[model samples]
Target chain A: EDQVTQSPEALRLQEGESSSLNCSYTVSGLRGLFWYRQDPGKGPEFLFTLYSAGEEKEKERLKATLTKKESFLHITAPKPEDSATYLCAVQEAKSSYKLIFGSGTRLLVRP
Target chain B: SAVISQKPSRDICQRGTSLTIQCQVDSQVTMMFWYRQQPGQSLTLIATANQGSEATYESGFVIDKFPISRPNLTFSTLTVSNMSPEDSSIYLCSVEDTREQYFGPGTRLTVT
Candidate 1:
């Protein structure tokens, strides 16, 4: 069965702190790995998509790196406004666009 | 790139009642998807709505329980039947273009 596991169910970091969230997945083959940020009482916002092993993508303060079996989302100098639940999902080789998501890591940044 | 919008941002309904959530995209999209996000949980795909075909439901979801309609390439609706406390969740609609997807704001449903 294809499954996704995310570590550190909840995380707290002070403003300007940097950390990384991990997502390990078990599947036949990883077609694509996605990262999304979701705010409370709203929908998920798109972040980045990594397609192959050794691939990495970055946005202002967020960087996502992928490997054969796991992906990491690294936050650099995160601010309180960047606090939200970060979700990691993967698309299996057989499925075209359907996604299997991890439970997600809730991050809180205090100022 | 697409901008998806959903209607009835939030609602409170009595048990056994039904509610319909609508999704609209600015540009025509090839596929639209409906998802359910329970409190503190990851998004669960409910169904995939195509332009001129029956919606394909995922495991644990049924057509009778959750009806979906895609009359055009840019619009769709998902109706939750027989609401229960478990049905209290945020329903989101997403549109796909190639590989990237854009999501709507979502509709918050509370069953009491």
Candidate 2:
């Protein structure tokens, strides 16, 4: 069975505080890992895609790094505007484009 | 990236009724998918809307309950049938572009 798990179900950080969210997976074969940010009552917005171990991608104040069994989304000096539920999903290599998603980590950056 | 939009951003429906959500993309896409997010739950794949063919539903989902239609490469519709309180959720549509998926604003449904 392919599964994705994200830790720290909820986090409250002060504005300008940096933090990291974790996503661990168990799959027969890894194809890709994805990160998304979803605001209240809205669909997810794509943030980054990590395909292989040791790979990393960054956008503005967010950086995502991947490993063989997990991925990390590091937020540097996060702002209140960046507060949202961060989602993690994985694609199995043998399966179609289906994505198995984690429960998500809800972050609140208080000003 | 592709820009996607959905109609009826939010709605409240009585139990046993039905509702249809529409998704439109800015450009033609080969793969379009529908997802459901139950209250406080992660997103789950409902089906893949294939153009000119019957949709491919994921496990735990059925066409009879959730019918999908893809009339063209850039448009799709998903209908929730025989709705109940348990069916209240956020329905989202996404398109695959350049090996990445882009999502629409989503339709928030509340069943009474």
Candidate 3:
């Protein structure tokens, strides 16, 4: 069974505060890991796709890093607009692109 | 990347009724998928919408309850039959071009 767990279900950070959200996964075979941002009542928007361990990607103030057993989404000096539910998903190597997603970490950036 | 458009952004339906959600992609796609998300929960895959074959449903989901149709490479529809309060959720349509998948805006369903 493939499972994904995220830490800090909810976090409230003041503006310019930095924090990192964790996504720990256990799968039969690792293919790829994905990160997304979803707003209220909307579907997830694509973020970064991590293919292998020790890989990192960044966009603006958001940076994502991948490890052997987990992935981290780091928010550096986040703005109010960056507040949303950040989701982590893992796709198994043998499966046909079906993703198992984490419960997600809700980030609230207060300005 | 594919751009997916889902119709009827939301709806309020009575119990035992049915609702069909449509997804149209801007370009050709090899695979289409449906997902369900309950309030404050993670997304669960419902089925794979194959163009020329019957859909493959995930565990706990059946074709009798949720039927899917993929008429072509860029279009598909998912119908939720015999709606209930438990069925009220966010239904999302996704298309996979290669290794990555893109999602629709989502349909928010509220069953009474």
Candidate number of the best lDDT: 2
Candidate 3 per-residue lDDT over residues B1-112, each given as its tens digit: 7888999999999999999999999998879999999988989999999989999999999999999999999999999999999999999999876678788999999999
Residue pairs in candidate 1 whose N, alpha carbon or C atoms collide under 3 angstroms: none
Worst 10 residues of 1 chain A by lDDT: A91-100
Please state how well chain A of candidate 2 matches the true chain A, as a TM-score: 0.98
Q: Among all windows of ten consecutive residues in candidate 2 chain B, which has the lowest summed lDDT?
A: B94-103
Error of 3 at B84 (Å): 1.1
lDDT of each: 0.92, 0.95, 0.94
Q: Could you tell me the interface RMSD of model 2?
A: 0.6
Q: If ranked by lDDT, best first, what sequence of candidates would result?
A: 2, 3, 1
Chain B TM-score, structure 1: 0.98
| Whole-structure CA lDDT of model 3 | 0.94
Every candidate's fraction of true contacts kept comes to 0.70, 0.77, 0.77
Error of 3 at A68 (Å): 1.0
DockQ scores of all models, one per candidate:
0.79, 0.86, 0.85
lDDT of 2: 0.95
Q: Which stretches of model 3 miss by more than 4 angstroms? A: none
